[model samples]
Target: MTDETRTSALQILRTLVGSPTADFHEGQYEAISSLVDGHSRALVVQRTGWGKSAVYFVATLLLRQRGGGPTVLVSPLLALMRDQISAAERAGVRAVAINSTNAHEWGDVVAALERDEVDVLLVSPERLNNPTFREQQLPALVARMGLLVVDEAHCISDWGHDFRPDYRRLRDLIAQMPSGVPVLATTATANSRVVADIAEQLGGAEVVTIRGPLARASLRLGVLRLPDSKTRLGWLLSHLGDLPGSGIIYTLTVSAAEDTARLLRDAGHAVRAYTGQTDTGEREESEGMLKRNEVKALVATSALGMGFDKPDLGFVVHLGAPSSPVAYYQQVGRAGRATENADVLLLPGTEDRDIWQYFATASMPDQARAERILSALERERPTSTPALEALVDIRRTPLELLLKVLDVDGAVRRVQGGWVATGEPWTYDAERYSRIAAERVAEQQHMIEYETTTSCRMEFLQRTLDDETAAPCGRCDNCAGAWYPTAIAADAAASAASSLDRVGVAIEPRAQWPTGADRLGLPVKGRIAAAERPLEGRALARLTDLGWGGTLRELFAPGSPDAPASAALIAACVRVLAGWGWKERPAAIVTMPSRRHPQLIESVAAGLSQAGRLPHLGSLEYLKGGPEGEPGGNSAYRLAGVWGRIGVPDALADDLAGLAATKPDSPILLIDDLVDSRWTITVASRALRQSGAAGVLPFALAVVR
Candidate 1:
């Protein structure tokens, strides 16, 4: 049986790679043999480009040839699914994918499955929870599945760097599989903890764990400490061209990615920004461009991580270090997959910790908020997320995440309409959460150590991942004495400085009232009235911007003193106004009464008014100490908190009326210290417009993205 399987697998492997001499890597054949011959569950923790996909594809065709059922592959990303399907086709296996993007083709896929034409079926973890697919298809698939494959399986472990709530549902799926059905889970990023967790979840002591050394022989690792974002950009400007081939330049935030991409393009480099905010079609196009080496590099955030297969990628450069060394290893593993040499460089920034903290907390479920969500859904009927938001204080993103966690915990169940409490009596695992948090802190410290370590960088990363065979590679900067250039060209430094100095971000006005406002007992609904809407406004910078973000973060940090704007900030605000390109100058300036930063808001209004030579019309009256709630709530709740809480004073009303009579086309500039929900600005603008202002132009010092 083993010899026959080997011959068959080698044939498929050669066909898959288009090479007659192609054969299995050291552990690939073992993984396949365990599944096909032993019919046992297996976990393959290998580096990227190790042909983990090949194990499953080869096993799948062999199983089907023996009259077994098709393989069900749970993949993570659309790009990955596309690549897998193409590879399966090369091996003469019919593959189909069911994901959000290709819902229209799901019926065709189902038809093909029924006809026994599909040898492999790929679906995302989220698809396992889809109402129709879960109820209508999963049970039947589980009954007949020849081999169950979980790609990027580290996501199933909470301790993993990129854990997904949806992936935890795999435990239920695994439990439901028919007895003797072989299972295979594969990942390129998993430390010892993650591997143990995944192995236990896959099937406990019966599972065969296969792990290889986590080191890339072709990767030359290095770290270059840069003082600020401008200097980092200068280094890239000076040295990007000198790197190998088309690669990735990773940033910590969306704004930074876009900013870096723009700067690189301005410097005549062929590059584009890829982030979560990028359109789906454009993301596909960008991936294609990068794979074909049509561009020099892609400026991207972590959204570009995992399942992006680019053999011979040449290099991977981090504009800011990731929070954990494991994550760094996973990202850098993307390079040198099938090449003799690839460059992996890290440019650690001062703001990296802040960014890491923000993301780390964003993923953890808050105990209080989770309890509130459960309490809101304890009623008899199913409640949609928006309706639940009206009843609870949590924002949409976090609220949805909490719901998924509860769903996985068996405390809540999603139905056709929305979600319902399962009455399963769930308890928050505070101890476990605390331990995970502590582990995260330790991992962050390890990442810092990795940046400053005098020891071998590659070996340090391997040890962080708990690779037993970790040893010095004699290749990284620390071991080989800086294989990368460190000098920044004078012209490149000037260009980077100029790019950072350029400021002004447009604040798009909120055009529509958030849905479920009526549930919150708010009168407003549907599109905001055109006349009441504020004109497109301007901000000095986004709170996430690579340039001004650090200063703004410090200024608005909790417990920070609320003082008047600094001379430099005031000047930056003036620069924003000068470059605004408004249709007409403002007739007067109106300030939003601030609860925390009254002095700051007033000073910015005064400074801009003085600079523009416009009359300062005083501040709007706060009916109830300004808006009720704090920052970071959903739009409906945020608007509800602000509605009827701001009023146009009689004096300011008369002043605006007088200005409207004299300068009918001119708008009243409304200034605020910060904009988060934008509901405050919308409400304030409506009040000013109702009080006889020709129009309102909203302005803010910074925007919280």
Candidate 2:
């Protein structure tokens, strides 16, 4: 607005970019002015690498110069926080973060904030509700806060692709902030509905929304539909090196990422797997390696999606299509940020829809489960998550997520001991949730349309983001006719097939009983007795594997008949058993009773017994059928459901009892079609060992992690 203010902002911008000619982008100047000069709430929806961080950094500097307190920045991911901290330092702004990784340094960070030394403080949304931090440190910071920034703010709206419950807590923070404190929410991918929702949550009608064009002219987008996983891997193995520079290869599942990365590395290419299961330290290392171009690519999942910054990334290849066009746009935006030309390709799989449905269902809260949780909390004192899991029928992961949603909705509060009911009237909005679910299904269909569309791929993505300026880019394969090669070499295809077809997954035994199991009337307590537990088991493949996952899904789908194991799957199971490397070879194979797939289990056991030259001692039959309901729930409930259901038949008892006399310490190989909670195997093995069997070793066709 004023000459002096412009000059100061421009001076800081130069330092931020390390260039004397650096200036704000299209909407950066407006956002900065609104936050600094106007002291107003603003929401900026711009494409990635469009200087969103610059607006906040410049505004924070200006506010600090005016003797304001430290700016509190709520960033979603640790990777993003790391990048923002580095950028802030480049501009001579004192920046630090209080996250899970840097717990040892929190006291020093708090001291700096107390002394007014921190120019900007970046924190994860989960930290906002930390008991000690919220009650002690956060209040002081909020009282003197100059500005509040929400990075990846699309997460605040449930309609966004990556909805996070922790992010919704920021609404209370915004409401509690001192009056006149400017708040800025920034995101690269937000449709009109999501943008409106975020603005409403921020300041309701008064929130200033500045949306820019969502087109990325530098990207050459394309879609290549391969027949199967092997062909897709073949195409990647053949053409990945041809891309401009080091970039990312995203997969829909962690197993796919790891398998792809392993295949690439084995072929003398530098690559690594980055996923949610990756260790924190290793994830940081992988990020640095990718940023420095030390590796050609990081095969990843959505874990590396938002807030990862690499300006010159040359390509982004999706091994499987994302569920929504908006999500695809966000991930592909990582490429061509600071390059003249970058390649983007989508390899959509038939199995993508199934994965989409699994994740989408996981995101929606179950009304009945929510009501159960609330009712349980109402009658009790503060209850810990472990204790609650034994009482409720939900698993730990979904239970914790549901608790967060309930906490933010004011139906519950997390206290020092645990969670307690707030007695607030909370209604289950089934209508809104159903609408969101329907919207998700629509997005999945839209993704299918994106793959099939012959029009400009860039235009399709831009339109998905609700950009009114959507048009042909004249660069995508659909517009320009296939810039990427589709040919796959014979040798490469063979190698990929071999790599993908290889299958064997270790099934770790359930070493300890879940907490509070005793309260559920089960004698099991902390550590499961070693003698009663089944030895470390082996599975032919994971149910979520990139190779065998599809076949297993079809076999396990509801209403699917009980059929014998296929020749190829049985052969794979034999290979898994061959590579088992157990301390003692089993003298007999015992199958578990499967109400749904009895033929499948017996077929697998008979095949393995014939191959290994071991006796097929028949299956453990259920006294009164198997467990009620489907497999899944807390450990105590699952164990209770399975206990006493399976037992060794009298016909097999004589042979099992003779194992001690014939082959002193030989193990009995307990075979099953699948393993979910491992409780059935645990109970069955316990029954066998109690019947004079020396030991029990479990083997399964597939493992559900």
Candidate 3:
């Protein structure tokens, strides 16, 4: 790095360390500050407690003080925005967060900006696309913008920690701003590829990387090699502090999160769980307990707890092996932040690799399956599951599995009534994700290799990242324990060899549904109130009468941190009805407007779709993930959006006309699931003729909207 760039990077961290709000350790400050310099746009690639947020917040304040036009911070989460703004305000910097929460209060922010009275402004990404904000307000105000900071910049790069195609547009928006308005992007983890992608999108901005030694000297790292999830859970309880400080247990699934939390509570921990499914209060309470040391541990999925800070957190233990090393590092880094002597534990089981493989591969639809979906859509018609079953020639088992992949990708939606296409068909672009996700997955594989190797685990990580240490990292379990280099060395070698011999991860095996599962495909026609009910039986029966007509799988919700699991079961049943081609409907979708910020909607959509299900988290997953303007999964947001806008047969007919008027290429009517709604086809056909979406064909299966 040039001396000037090196100095500039150093100064950013130094400035934060020197701030009245903080006096971080010299080395820690250096490590964090080192990220600031010449990288016009960079993802920080560290964990929550690594002081990454401080690095950027300080940058904002500094830029503002230097007469930088008010800095614009697009936070991925409302909580993160509030936290940063609160911290900035405490440090005597004027910052305000504008969101749907205080819809009317925005006048003050506008007044302050007009008066040049504010130093920083924080907003969720959706706020940027707001029709009024985009056309009328921001153009004039941001014209004088000094700096643009995207807190979770990963959202912008398809390769970064998170992938959001819509996020890719930020680069274009930022580049259009007046020349002097610099952009700073930061994340906890981004490999060389993700960094490169971000830079490429950022008008060819240069990247300045600050990856220091991997070893946390004062923190102890331990690995528990167990045989299965059950045994691992037992081990976690044994290690439980039996104290108030919060610890988190990482699980692979939302259902797992619920199950684990129940197990812990039954074991007498007064514990709670958070996933993409828990209620807002539940999530908030779980976190609150952690911050207040009211609960000793929390069970959650991999994506939870970004931008959450709890100094003096005693430990972070993973009940599962995360898919990648970057994820592991981020998860474990949660501990040892407020003090030395904190611990991080990872409980590895036999199927750990299998689980990782499931996420990576299951996420990518098989080529043949993708092709089938495309062919069906090209014909401008929605096919039933049975129809798809014939086309793909797979046993019902594998066909069901492929269906989930399509559902997650927004290619299809399901409901109590049937299923239909919300948008275009599935198109695989290996260049879009495989390379980046592989690199991310490989990093985790490398960690497994390193841990299994005879050499010290800490030493391996440190030596790889910082490149100076050949000596052992005496602090790790391997370095101090009996499993050191002897037999482990041989095993790790074999593991690496086997890893190289295999093909990349593939889709997960299908989960078994009930024998008499009544189902449908998208293009649902029903009342939104169907999903709003809490009774599974009523929901199912109502959906069936509306149009649903397929055998559904066993409905099982292990816990109810949100509503009774019964309510969730009904929602699931209704979705089955919608996804199976019940009818084209929208009113049957928006039972209620979004009660949370925007970000949660994103996470819910992405999380559900990732699981090979549709993104209709409804009240259950919505409260669990957070609201709009909160950081969430891309898959979830899209699903919720489609589901939210769904209407009845009449409404679907109207929207069909509306969309046709918009003239979507090869326009087709969307349905969640399908039943035999008489009005659906006739009304849809009339609407298509009226508005003119070329080759208009309504699509759905086990009907959902």
Q: Tell me the number of clashing residue pairs for each predicted model.
A: 0, 0, 146
* TM-score for each candidate, following the candidate numbering: 0.98, 0.98, 0.57
Q: Write down the lDDT of every candidate, Cα atoms only.
A: 0.90, 0.89, 0.51
Model 1 lDDT per residue over 1-705, tens place: 468778988999999888999989989989999999899999999999889989999999888988899999999888888888888888888999999998899999999998989899999987899888999998888888999999989889875523578999998999998899999999988888989999999989999999998889999999999899889999999999999998999998999999999999999999999998999899999999999999999999988888788898999999999989878887888888899999999999999898889888988988999888888895479998888887888888889889999998899988888999988888999997888889899989999999999999999998999998999999999999999888999999999988987789999999999888888899888999999999999989998998887789998988999999899889988999989999988888999888889888988887888889988989998896667878758888899899999999899988988888888889999998889889999999999999988888899888998
How far in Å is the alpha carbon of 57 misplaced in model 2?
0.3
Point to the candidate with the largest lDDT: 1
lDDT of 2: 0.89
Q: Which portions of model 1 miss their true places by more than 4 Å?
A: 160-163, 378-380
Candidate 1 similarity to native, TM-score: 0.98
What is candidate 2's TM-score against the reference?
Answer: 0.98
lDDT of 3 by residue, 1-705 (tens): 456544544555455445434454433344333333332544455434666666656655555645667878787755466567766765556888888777788888898889988878888765775556767778986788866777766667643323233365576577679764556666655555555666676666354444434566656666767654445555555546442256777776664566567666765766777776676556666677777878777788864655666667777777667765656666666676767667666776555564576466644446776666545542335566655543443435445555544554556644322345657646766675567666756666776875577667656655444335336767778777742111223433443333222211111111221121222232433332221211110123221110111121111112312222233334443354345332332211211123322332333233334343432313212233322321111222222323323223355445545554554443342221222221222233333334333332232222211
Query: On residues 1-705, what C-alpha lDDT tens digit does candidate 2 reach at each position?
Result: 788999999999999999999878888888999999899999999999898999999999999999888899999888889999999999999999999999999999999988889999999988998778899898989999999999989889875523578898999999999899999999998999889899998988889999999999889999999999999999988888898899999999988899899999988889999999999999999999999999999999988988788999999999999989878988999998999988999999878988898889887888999999998995348998988998898899899989988988889988888899999999988888888888888888889999999899989988888899999999999888999899998988998989977878887888898787787788878887888888888887777887787788889887999989889988988888888899999999888877779889888888888899999988888866667546866788888888778888888998887878999899999988888888888889899988878889898888886
Model 2 bad stretches (over 4 Å) = 160-162, 378-380
| Worst ten in a row by lDDT for model 2 | 157-166
Every candidate's CA RMSD: 1.3, 1.3, 17.4
